[model samples]
Target: MHDAASALNPQALAEAAGAAMYARDTASQSLGMKLIEIRPGYARMTMPVRADMLNGHLTCHGGFIFALADSAFAFACNSHNLNTVGAGCTIDYLAPGRQDDLLTAEAVEQALAGKTGIYDVTVKNQDGRLIATFRGKSHRVSGEVAPVQR
Candidate 1:
């Protein structure tokens, strides 16, 4: 079993893990976030700025932006099929996301060691304007996101 799992294609494993996680992620689905791409230690997601997501200033709420980035971070960290959770995270909003804008969050793994990993995410609009930058620290737990296929 170990040999078979180890022999599995890395890209295939990442895709499978992402699909399995997305299927059970109600928050992402309900918020209109779409998993755009996935690979080993990388993930990209997109969410549209809807009217309901605006804050008092009529800009997209920071929580919503954070959630998008966090989802991307979650997907990237768990790409190896291990169940990983965020240990800590920080985000800086660079610009306001206007309604009707299509926002995209791209997360890249900066480092991975033992049971912990670091990821950086950049949130951008359809026109490629920067919206936010997020960094997340992840801690792996005991569990496979998807059962290994022989």
Candidate 2:
């Protein structure tokens, strides 16, 4: 398994990871998250702020924004073809998200050491307004994301 993994190129690994993860990700699909781009240690995703996702203040709920960021982080950390899971995460809201807004989240890996990694996701609106920033720590477990050629 390790030899098969090591034999795959970086881009091949990322593509396989994305395909495998998307096939099993129901929550992201159910929430209407659109995957824009993915590569090794990076991912971009978009979500529309729907009316059903609004809070009492008539703005998009913080939870929905956090979810979008989290999904982006998950994809970024897992792009290495490892079965990685989030160990911890944090988000800070900068601006209120409104209904009908197209929010895009871009996540990038900050550090990877041993079995742990750190990622940062920036959530922004279509108008380029920052909505939130998220940080996620990931832990890679013992599994391959997909079969690879040795």
TM for candidate 2 is 0.94
Clashes of each: 0, 0
Q: What is the lDDT of candidate 2?
A: 0.92
Ten residues in sequence with the least summed lDDT for candidate 2: 1-10
Q: Identify the leading candidate in terms of TM-score.
A: 1
Q: What is the TM-score of each candidate against the true structure?
A: 0.95, 0.94
Candidate 1 on 1-150: residue-level lDDT in tens? 234755388887798899999999999999999999999999999999999999999999999999999999999999999899999999999999999999999999999999999999999999999999999999999998988757
Off by over 4 Å in 2: 1-7
Best of the candidates, lDDT: 1
lDDT (C-alpha) at residue 2 in model 1: 36
